[model samples]
Target chain A: MPKKEVLLEINHLKAYFPVKRKSMKEEKKVVKAVDDISLEIYRGETLGIVGESGSGKSTFGRTILKLVEPTEGEILYKGQQIQHLKGSNLQKYRNQMQMIFQDPFASLNPRMRIGAIIEEPMALQLTLTKEQRKKRVKELLQKVGLAEDAMHKYLHEFSGGQRQRIGIARALAINPEFIIADEPVSALDVSVQSQVLNLLMDLQDEFQLTYLFISHDLSVVKHISDRVAVLYLGRIVEIGTKKELYANPLHPYTQALLSAIPVVNFDEPKQAIPLQGELPSPMNPPVGCVFHTRCPFVMGKCHQVRPTMQEMNEHQRVACFLYDK
Target chain B: MEPINTQQVLLEVSNLKIQFQLKNGKQAKVVDDVSFSIHKGETVALVGESGSGKSITSLAIMRLLPIPPGEITAGTIHFNGNNLLDYKNKEMSHIRGNDISMVFQEPMTSLDPVFTIGNQLMESIRRHRKVSKKEAREKAIHLLQEVGIANADKMIAEYPHQLSGGMRQRVMIAIAMANNPQLLIADEPTTALDVTVQAQILNLMMKMKKEHRSAILFITHDMSVVAETADRVMVMYAGQIVEEAPVRELFLNPQHPYTTALLKTMPSLDTDVERLPSIPGIVPPAYALPDGCRFAPRCQFAMEQCQTLQPEVLTVNEAHKVRCHLFSGKEERAYAEEGSLT
Candidate 1:
């Protein structure tokens, strides 16, 4: 293994939301959105967090940046655990970690001009004069491939790809070493998608940034990620390098997820081993392995016992009964 | 199931041109001189960007293009050997949804929130075909089952809001195929859908094409979907078919500059590039199009002659055809020589 410098280390991260009371005497039920997830993000490397909807991939990314308060976990940024910090300390930590939201339309304020929107992050984190901030915003916009003069235009005036570029520029306002891009290119067209992705790759090289890029697109993950983690029903089912995960995927869930992607070539035929059913309601997930209900190679032990993450090889980790000795 | 026959043309559309009347009363062509023939049960994809006139072309064929602002100025849209563009409102109504139906991009907003799937499905059958409530209800269930709904019986009672996005889309497909239409027009059917659901839907549509023998004109921007499903592909840009070829041939060897750029811009899943390339500028608006070739501004091999003279469609091979000056060897060699020097 090449010297993996840990940028962010998260251990036993859990986020639970309170469910409504059924009766007056009933205790509030806790929705285990993110049960227990342990992860390591390396310096200047893209760590892909991938999952279906309601898989807690988005929650895990947000909780790491302290956007949402965690019920339980120890998040070590650099070397220090930043779980209970508040006020100035929390603000300082936030400057180091920035997040790009999924929806460009909802993430940006519709009323604000493009320039002001990008400048808002810098104004909140840094103390700079108006002239300095404006100059910085212009530079940031140009870096993201937006025109300098288009600062006066509102978010609605810009296209989906252009808006996402603005969103990226805002995330880069404080020169944050780490970024959490939550499905940044999912909304754009395929032609425009490559542009945004290329820009992201370019920005990463220029800044030496670490990315916790969260998306459902495995192809995108495979293209950019140094390490890819597959999440299923609030659990990281598999974690390995991009080559290991795609070439020889261990977990049945990962296998199904990868096979589901439509092969672009018409010449090559793929025998799809589809997951039998839809992901069961997150409110009432199955016992033991959450994926066992849909896993093609389900074992008798899988239904009764939950599989823990076990290292199968030097860099590959899989949570599946089939992988167990 | 309708048997596949190569000679049988289910929908033969020729020289179809639609224009929108501007505030000055002058008409601006949106779909200019488009022609294609779709065989029974064959999937033909009309592909392009936001203003490529792909969607408008589909709407024109359906005779659903909004009037006043929009009009099918010239062209013959022949479906089942009938001139559909010349049909009166009542005459066109019989063809619309009875012989041909459409599925839109946004499935969620397209459906009525209050109506149950049962009512919507039955309404289409009852409205078009002279069928009683009981027979229509049974057909609706069968239609639901045909589109891959697990419990078609129970799902019919549930409202649109009650079902998942994929299920609702299946319901929409059920309605489109209610009267056993020979043709189906789908505009970005899988755009709002996730890849898994999208795969399921496309596979479902492909399966249905085999079973029903329905000719489908699918409008989409997804190159992957086009590569996977389309039998014949049309590359539209700025209200013209810049290139048209067999699906495999188009991707493998794209002749047009725009088509080549589009293929290059897409990040390959199987192959990785050091830096993903992009065409420098945004697609120019239709209102302010270049006088000669619409794609000249974005074309990498644009010459001085490209700005002055418009190129006619040139035959590359038996199956492939492209509208480009490069193929004709008409490119200004002196200008090209100068370009190489710079």
Candidate 2:
């Protein structure tokens, strides 16, 4: 198979939020939401980001879409550095990289009609007449399995599944090359979640779209992602293909996270690695390794020195001293 | 393991029908003619999506629904050989938290923000059991430690906000187990926690239930939780019990189309599939339901009779029961004979 070109790349990305001190004598603190991460999103492949809450998966997606400003790092779009771009350049970057938020209800405008909600992106991204935008909105609605008459409905009129479809239509309205979907189907019910997931997959194939799918559910992540990244407090602890990650997980954190998932089959047994404690607060993460406090196989070095991502094999990478050569 | 007594029924609901009064002065049946029994020391899971009336059924058992908008229109809830519906509020209050306890989904909000963990746990102990303040405090610490809290002494003094989500849920479980109730109603107890934390909570619940020998009514949407904890599984849809069977048999051979569809839609970690087979339509609204089966619109094997006539519950086997026409009488017998031949 021919190599796929990298569509987006990140170099040493860091996003931190500084917290105010309670008093003058208290020291300032910072929440390392996304701390020093680097990876590449290849063209036409879905790269999934999985983690628990506060693992910085959503923040990382936001940083890539320029929704959240990076404290430090270089984000390149098709080999061009675009993080610090302003004005028209920034708008152009936003046009290429769209985001689908987790909550369908809050993400959509309550007062706006469905047609206007979808067409708003097109109006901002491209200079099109009202008639042209309406025409595209109707076509997009049909593509997402909704009837053309749905163009006149309000956000409140549709159910959770239908509202999610509308959210997808808005994301595709800009004709984005990269979509950072952050927990897109988490808000819907199980029966409805699959419908939305299938729709997203079909759209990805139809539009030839590359997706950075972010979710906390590993099973959902496994179904949609070609390559998967496991995040800890604020860092990518492991990255590999779905087969490599599922069949042979290198990182202990990844193993524990995957094993903890509740499989539907009764006889398909699983070995759950019960971590010692809860996830530490991002504001005061451990010095050596962020996961060492909860990691079962913690070595002395893990408490004194941080581990960096190292290549374990051809397609798998891990950030643990156990794999250090 | 000793076999549970099939004759000893802990909780039995007969033809439970719940109605909700809408704002426009109209009423709709939210839980329609649902009936099931929980055996002593058995873990039965109530599984369904949102608006399926699973939560409402659990709430009905607890008598927690708001009376203005919600009412138990018809049916009787018999718990421990007594009709809970027949009991007055005073008697009901005495039985609640003493014989039956519930653990809600969101532990963050379920706990009292102002009270310390010790204060909350002790309150339940003192309220249910006739124990002194000092004894209750000691029992509180013991319960906390029993639920796997390492620093039970200092942790009991901490407020709910200071504890993590997992710790808060453990505290909730500890409080629920303080009086050693015969029945524990856990309504999506571990849904909000992370996966690792969820595993811990589930393990802790199972261990606690085993030690106390409490029959648990585990309510959740995830089938994996059911597989891990429940002995019998009950699938609910549109305010009705669509299928009921032993956990292994239900997972291996689902009789209802809705149950099969639900199992198929869940993405498995063991297998790699391009796309999940999804049920097309959503659950019908309570106000506007189909004349026949609630899932007929989304059922792949739905027939003309399914859309027009309601099907009675048919016995698939000695333990398995289904409310679908396809599994009724001769068809089910033919399928069974075919299985025997195979």
- Superposed on all Cα atoms, the candidates' RMSDs to the truth, in angstroms, are 3.0, 2.2
**Top candidate when judged by TM-score against the true structure:** 2
In DockQ terms, which candidate is top? 2
Write candidate 1's Cα lDDT for A72-177 as tens digits: 9899999898989999999889888789987889999999999999999878866898999999999999999999987999998777888999999999999999
Candidate 2 lDDT, B1-342, residue by residue in tens: 676565699999999999998997776779999999998888999999988899999988988888968999999999988999988899988888889999999988999999999999999999878889999999999999999999898998999999899999999999999888889999999988999999999999999988888899999998878988899999999999999999999998988888888888888788777888889988988988899988899987777888999989888898899999988756676555555211
- Model 1, residue B33: what's the lDDT? 75
lDDT of each: 0.84, 0.90
lDDT of candidate 1 over B75-193, digit per residue (tens): 79888788887789999888888889999988789889899989999998998989889999999999988988888899889998888778888888888888778999999998877
Estimate the TM-score of every prediction. Answer: 0.94, 0.97
| lDDT of candidate 1 at residue A45, scale 0 to 100 | 95
| Cα misplacement distance, residue B172 of candidate 1 (Å) | 1.6
- lDDT score of residue B128 within candidate 2: 77
Candidate 2 CAPRI level: medium
Which docking class does model 1 fall in?
medium
